[model samples]
Target: MIRMPAEWETHAATWVAWPHNRMDWPGKFAAIPFVFAEIIRHLGRRERVEILVRDAAMEARARGVLDRAGALSANVRFHALPTDRIWLRDSGCCFVRDGDALGAVQWRFNAWAKYDNFQQDAEVAGFMARAAGARGRRAGMVLEGGSIDVNGRGTLLTTEECLLSKVQERNPGLGREGYEKAFAEHLGIRKVIWLGDGIRGDDTHGHVDDLSRFVGERTVVTVVEPRRDDPNHAPLAENLRRLRAATDQDGRPLEVVELPLPGPLTYRGIRLPASYGNFYIANGLVLVPVFNDPNDRVALDLLASLFPDREIVGIYSGDFIWGFGAMHCMTQQQPALAVGE
Candidate 1:
């Protein structure tokens, strides 16, 4: 049976595309590369960092920045490939393990169904699969990794706003049943915990990664807005209620933890999607996105406690979020396979 591994599980490598499409970051493009380099520096020492570059020139540029930051290391590898944006989590392959065999689920990426320049982004999965010598299979459904969180034990977390709603509908005729079947066949998901809407000002409509996540098989940490007057208060509160009543694939109660939202971060009058829930879990470290908010310490402390054995490091993302994503959005983990596989 093919099963998707949990984020906290051991990783073979982390895939990230070098930021080249400056249009995504608008006025804040120059600083985006430095942010990615900083993230790579932390991840390179832990596991392989597979970086995608559009061409040789782009790779050299990336190398210069990484070298300047003292991040160029033996653990970092580059692949020349075309890309439209830097959000690899949604565009990249979802690796699975079936016995001793490694596989890649090449889901159809439509740029969250919100953009028109995803032609190159859609091919990322297949390319990654070929590079890793994995058995590649194209999923029938158009799904993004950011839209769902799996426990690696058959349970999954997603949102109705991103999947079911007509606004930016991913699959035209596929309903909850269709999605659950796809999850079961591909990711080995048996139970699905459907949450409500996502955080406000999130471009991907309601990706669950920005709202809730599975920290463990029976543990989930979700974002909550304490201010009832805020627009995100009602939706986040409802999602928390669902999590409290939710169960895992084996019908056990889930231990729900609350993570506060980094108070509204705005750039050019637009509110960026800044949440402690967007943190990325690596092999030996957890990279969290901090927005210079008062809750930065609170979020870091809570995640540190949750991942006691793993080092927790916060990356300042005040400029990165302006591109409509953070650390988790930019990285996709490749689960390590069994020895001798």
Candidate 2:
């Protein structure tokens, strides 16, 4: 049986693309490359970092930045690949394992159905699968990696806002049954935990990575906006309520840990989705996005307690979130095969 491993599981490598589309970041594009370098530095020390660059010049530029930042390491490898954006969590492949075999679910990505320039991003999963030398399967439906979080066991967490809503309309004719069947077949999921709407400024309609994430097989850390006046308060409250009432695959109650939001972070009069729930778990580290808010300490301490064995590093994401994504959105983990394990 194929099983999609959890983010906290051992990873052979982490996939990330160099930020190129200045339009995504607007005027704040210059600092973006350095932010990526910092992320690569931390990840390269823990596990191999597979970086995707546009071409030779882009790769050289990335290397210069990495070298200058003292993040250039032996574990870092670069691949010349074209990409429209840096959010690999949606464009990259979702890897699975069955015994000693590794597989890649190449789900269709259409820039979250919000942008017109996603043809290159659509081919990313196939390239990722071939690069990892895993058996690749093209999913029959459109699904983003950030839309669903699996627990390596049999349970999966997702949001109805992302997959079901008519706003983005990822799959028109497909409904819950079609999605569940696809989940069962592609990722070996037996239980699907559906949450409500996402945060206010989420560009992908309502990606669950910004709202909730599975920290363990039966444990999840979901964001809770406590202030009643805030736009996110209602939806986040409803999601928290659902989590408290939900159960896992075997009907056991889930241990839902509440993570506080970074308050209302905005850039150029636009609200950004600055969430601690968007943290990425790598081999020996947990990279969390910090908005330089007061609650950064609270979120860090909570995640540290949850991941006692792993080092939790908070990256200043004040500018990164302006692009509507953070650490987790930019990174995708490749689970280790049997031999690597």
Candidate 3:
């Protein structure tokens, strides 16, 4: 059985793309590589940090940044894998383990149905399969890692606004049932729990990683906004309701934990898609995206209790959010494979 492990599970390595595209980060491009270095520094302590750079020159540039952050460790490696953009979570390969063997699930990537230059990004999974020496299984559907969250067991969490939207139609003619069946066939999921929509200003429509995430097999930390006047107030409330009512594969209600949203963060009057929910779970640490909002400590405290075993570290992502995403959007985990089936 092919199974995608939970983020909290042991990882052989965490893969991320080094930020080089000025267009992706706009005026804040100069500072984004430091954030990547900070992230690598955190992940390298526990596991390998595999970074994809466009070329040798970009690798040199990344090395300078990592060196400055004191993150130039042996576990942090660089790969000359070019890409159209830096959001590797949506464009990178998702590895699944089948007994003792590991393979890559190469889902179709179309720049989230909103960009024109995604050919290079679309080819990343094949490159990843070759690099990791993992077998590749190409799916006939379009899916982004950020659009789905999973528990290693058998259940998944996703949003309707992302998978079934007409505006950003990922896989045309594929409905809820079609997607549910595909999840089972590709990722070994048995239950698909769907939420209504995502928070506003999300470029990828409604990626679940920006709204909710599974902390364990039965517990989830979903983002909620209490201020009724906030744009995310109603949509997040509805998602929470759906989650509380949903059950796992064995028919048990899910444990829904609330993570308060950091008050609205806007850059140049544009509401950046900033969320405490966009946190990455590493082997011994959880890298959370923190804005300058007062809720940064609050979000970290709540997560510390939920993930008692792992150290919770907050990365200042105020500049990184100018790219419309945070640390989680830039990474994909390769679960550790066991020896002998």
Candidate 4:
């Protein structure tokens, strides 16, 4: 049987692609590399960090940032892999463990159905599967890593807006049942919990990572907006309602905890997706995104209670979110090969 492990499980390494596309971040490319380095600093301390670079020149520049941040390069491996964008979570390979060996599901990516320059990003999963020495299976579904979250057990979390909606529709005719069938066959997920929608300003339709995330086996930390005037209030509240009534693969009630959304972060008038739900869970740390909002500490404190065994660290992602993603969007974890692989 194949299973997608939870983020808290031990990882062989965390994968990150170097940000070299200035068009994605616009005028803020200068600071994005440093943010990646700071994230590598925390992740390198816990597990091996594999850095993907387009070329030697890019590797040298990434090394400079890692050096300045005092990140240990011994375990930081660099790959000469070129990518169109830095959102590797959506483009990278999704790992599944079968017994002791790790396998990968190469989910097709259409650049979130919003861009035509996604040809390079579409083939990333095949490359990643080769790098991990794992057998790869094609999912044949237009899916992104940010669109789904799993409990490493049998339950998978996603959103209706991302996989099933007509607006920014992916896999044109693939409704909930079709998508769920594909997930079960490819990732061995027995249950899928679908939420309403994502936060406003999300370019990937509605990625669940920006709205809801599974923090434990049967517990989730979802974002909520209190003000009715805000655009995100109704959608988040509706998702919270769905989560409260949802159950896992075993029919157990889910313990849903509400995470606060950071204040609306805008650049020139465009509101970037700046929610705290995009945090990444590593071996011994949870890397959260903060937009300099007053609720940054509150979000961190709440996560600390849920992840008491691990250190909870916040990374400033105001400039990075201009591309509309954060720490979780930039990284993907490869679970450690279990015993007897």
Candidate 5:
């Protein structure tokens, strides 16, 4: 059993899949790689960034974007691989440690509640885990990185909307107890703190990253929308209530910090799930997604307060969210724990 660490202090590296699929972004696909490049640039300044690309051509294209953005750092590296989409946080390997040796728990990815074609994305875990110097162990259970949040101590945060939904068919026969045992054995988690639901307009069937994230050992920052008439209002409110009542593995109540949700940003007549709560904590900086909305400043200010030691920078996410996710959804972190340190 291997337990994944918290993102705040973990140190292995960051993984990202370069955007290449035209169908994913429709008429807007050309702009996504630049967004990914910006994110990579931010992460490269802190720790190693391992980018997955389909081939040499894609790698060159991605590199060109990074070079132009001046985001190319010595720590950035590329792995030429095949992928259907660019959401690495859902399909990338989830690294854990057994004392000093690194291992990976391969969760079954079903395209975020079986929403899209994911044949290549499903095989990405093994490919990425092996590349990162971890022994890949197939768990054969349906899970996504966005679906779970870890507190580094033994608690995990998740929602019923994503993990328990029948539409995903990832955990068909598995119940709560079964999932608990599986998580304990695979990811080394001792407690699973379940929330009720996720915000509306989330396409991944309620990834926890869109709703709540563990900012500290006993604290979580979640998105809150007070508009009662809005579709996301009630669900997020309920999640906030649950977070207030939930406790970690040590039986301590979580300190909940509320982040304001950006006013609905629509493109092509579709409401994109733009959120500041989807920020990714890296080695030296916190990469946050910033929509070109007024709340961008407020979200950045609040995140700066949460990550007092790290540099918090916001990338324009107005164009990125058209693909249905922001920064955290596009990358996964590999903890830097060595064997038996």
Candidate 6:
């Protein structure tokens, strides 16, 4: 059994898959790698960054871009492995800690609701875990890294839309109770807090990172769209209300932090799901996705307050969000040390 660790802890490295597929990006594929490279720059400063490439040729191309952008650091390394896409948040290993040792739970990746072709991406977990020198355990159940959040205690935050759906066929025999047991054994999670739905434009079928996130133990930062006419207004409002009413593993009420959603961001006739809730926490920094909107400052200020010790930096995600996700949806973390280490 493998149990995922909390995001606030130390990390040995971060995992990212280089963006290469133009089909996923349509005509804007050229700009996406630069965005990824910028993120790599931020991550590489603090800890090691392991980037997955299709082959040596792709690695050379990515390296060239990184060099041009001045984004490559000594901590950044490349792995020439084939992958379906660049979103590591969906296909990477979920790192956990067992006593003092690190273990990984390799969940079945199906390209989120089995939307895209993910034959190679599904095998990323095992490859990433082995490269990171962690024990990998393959779980028959399907899951995504962005779908679940841990408090470093025993509580997990997720949405029913992603995990409970029968359409994806990830969990055929696991009902809610069965899921609880599976999570308990594999992830060392004692309680599962299920939210009703995710944001509207999310194609991943309600990843919790887009709707709600655990900022701290017994505390969550949720996106809120106050306009009743807006599509996400009701669902996000309901999620906030649920967080306010929910209790943690200690039987205490959760402290809910309300974060405003950026106004609708569109590109090439497509409205992307851009929200401030999808921020990634790293070793010494919190990388947030900025939509080039006025609300970017507000979101940065709020997240900065959340993590005073760590630096809060926001990168323009207008081009990156075109793929329907942002920074948090593109990267995964590996813990540096376990709880007892």
Where does model 1 exceed 4 Å of error?
A: none
Candidates' RMSD to native: 0.9, 1.1, 0.9, 1.1, 1.4, 1.5
Q: Name the lDDT value of residue 42 in candidate 4.
A: 95
- Per-model TM values vs. the true structure: 0.99, 0.98, 0.98, 0.98, 0.96, 0.96
lDDT of 5 by residue, 224-244 (tens): 998888898888888988889
- lDDT of each residue in 140-202, candidate 6, tens digit only: 878888888889888999888788876565677677888788788889888888997888778
Q: What is the model-wide C-alpha lDDT for candidate 4?
A: 0.90
Every candidate's lDDT: 0.93, 0.93, 0.91, 0.90, 0.85, 0.85
Estimate, for each residue in 1-341, the C-alpha lDDT of model 1 and write its tens digit: 78999999999999999999889889889999999999999999999999999999999999999999999999999999999998988999899986688899999999888899999998899999999888998896799999999999999999999999999999998999999999999999999999999887799999998888888889999999989898999999999999999899999999999999988888888888989899999998999999989999999999998999999999999999988889899999999886885
Model 3 / residue 313 / CA error / Å:
0.5
Error of 4 at 94 (Å): 0.3
* Candidate 6 ranges beyond 4 A from true positions: 1-3, 167-169, 338-340
Q: Give the C-alpha miss distance for residue 195 in model 1, angstroms.
A: 0.3
Q: 283, model 4: CA deviation in Å?
A: 0.8
Steric collisions counted per model: 0, 0, 0, 0, 6, 1
TM for candidate 1 is 0.99
Better of 1 and 6 by lDDT: 1
Question: Which pairs clash inside model 6?
Answer: 2-186
The local lDDT score (0 to 100) that residue 316 gets in candidate 3 is 97
Q: Tens digits of per-residue lDDT for model 2 on 78-124?
A: 99889989899999999999657889999998889889999999889
